[model samples]
Target: MPKRIPLQRRGRAKPKFRPRTHKSLGKIELPKQENTGIILDLLHDNIKSAPIMKVRFGKDVMLLAATNGSRVGENIMIHKLADLPEGSLVCNVESRPGAGPKLIRSAGGAGRIVGKEGKLTSVLLPSKEIKKIHSECRAIVGRVAGAGMTEKPMLKAGAGFYAMKAKGIIWPRVRATKKNAVDHPFGGGGKTLGKKKTVSRHASPGRKVGSISARRTGKRRGKK
Candidate 1:
């Protein structure tokens, strides 16, 4: 006899929300510094001139917007760090309102504000597409969080395994259980029968639930 495939079982469900929220000291006022970093690249030109500045942080290159009084080869602290770029239009954002900076609504899609020009601002989209935006859109200034902010740790052997296990994100591998004739009394050797045993004779007639059988109930003849 050939070996039968084991049935799959359900596992424990994961929690929908995290218990603790990430907290920061909030926004602080600080003096603007001079631009002394290397020129990265221009984000937006013609439509709404805005540039993307790259500054050296240790060995890492931090990409920031060249906001007011900023230019290429200038070392200026990103006066504002928004959840997204200033003129960016976003939907389904995972941010608290009036908490930090919010994204603006974009005609094509979501983006981030990079630089400002009078009543207009520059925005960077997910596709790396840069464009101009209106200044009326609310924005916030701050340094971008360090790398690894979006990267999750991998579950590995030993301490990493136990840590993930405690978080309910990792668990032991389970083997499938064998099924027998008692579980499924059909030709197939498995728990659930390969085919339905109770074949309805009248199924072809298109009978439906809660429907009156005209033949059995009898219909009025000639409005009698």
Candidate 2:
């Protein structure tokens, strides 16, 4: 095969857009549920705004996205509770007992069991996608915490650099056109990379820059 083409982002290769999470956060007592699971430590991850929630499920331990003020040592029921209060964070909620929660599990992500229809329970995810899960699948109540994280401005390039450094990421990328012609497709002679910015889908690595395989070029004229 042709080296199994790697995915590209905006004509360039980049890493996944997720934060690096910290695993160790010392030790803390977990909340005790009568017969259910309990939420453990609330810690900070590489993603400044999206907090992490540690919980224990039937001897298996895991870290979930912190939401709805899930605090340390709090009783969290993993299945069918008296009532799922508004702004709760739930996961592993499947139609079948062991299907496993498969939706809306992300940083600053959440879902709610809005309505019930016989066996299928309607859950509106963070993306506003409606999914049907089991009534007894179980979820945690309360919105994922760390609200207003995205509202903060980067302010300066240095601030952004240090922030991404915590996650071991390279920040403040340079434009490809700024390099020499031998370096990037848009590179060279004048301040402008090139008058044209389109490339073919089968272009080689060095020449594969700008609009790839675009069907049309230039702005379209309005109807006469």
Return the top candidate by TM-score: 2
Query: Mind sharing the TM-score for model 1?
Result: 0.25
Model 2 misplacement above 4 A: 1-35, 47-49, 80-102, 114-120, 131-138, 153-155, 165-169, 177-182, 189-195, 215-224
lDDT per residue (tens digit) for residues 9-63 in model 2: 3235343433444533422222233336677677766544457777776686766
| lDDT (0 to 1) per candidate | 0.37, 0.59
Model 1, residue 220: C-alpha shift (Å): 56
User: Could you give candidate 1's per-residue lDDT for residues 1-224 as a string of tens digits?
Assistant: 43322221112232422211122112222213332345454343221112334455344454443343445565443223233454443421213322323332121224556677775656675568765644433332322222232355554567555544444443443222232443323433555545543434454222221223333343567855
lDDT of 1 at 187: 30
In model 1, where is the ten-residue run with the lowest total lDDT? 16-25
State which candidate has the highest lDDT.
2
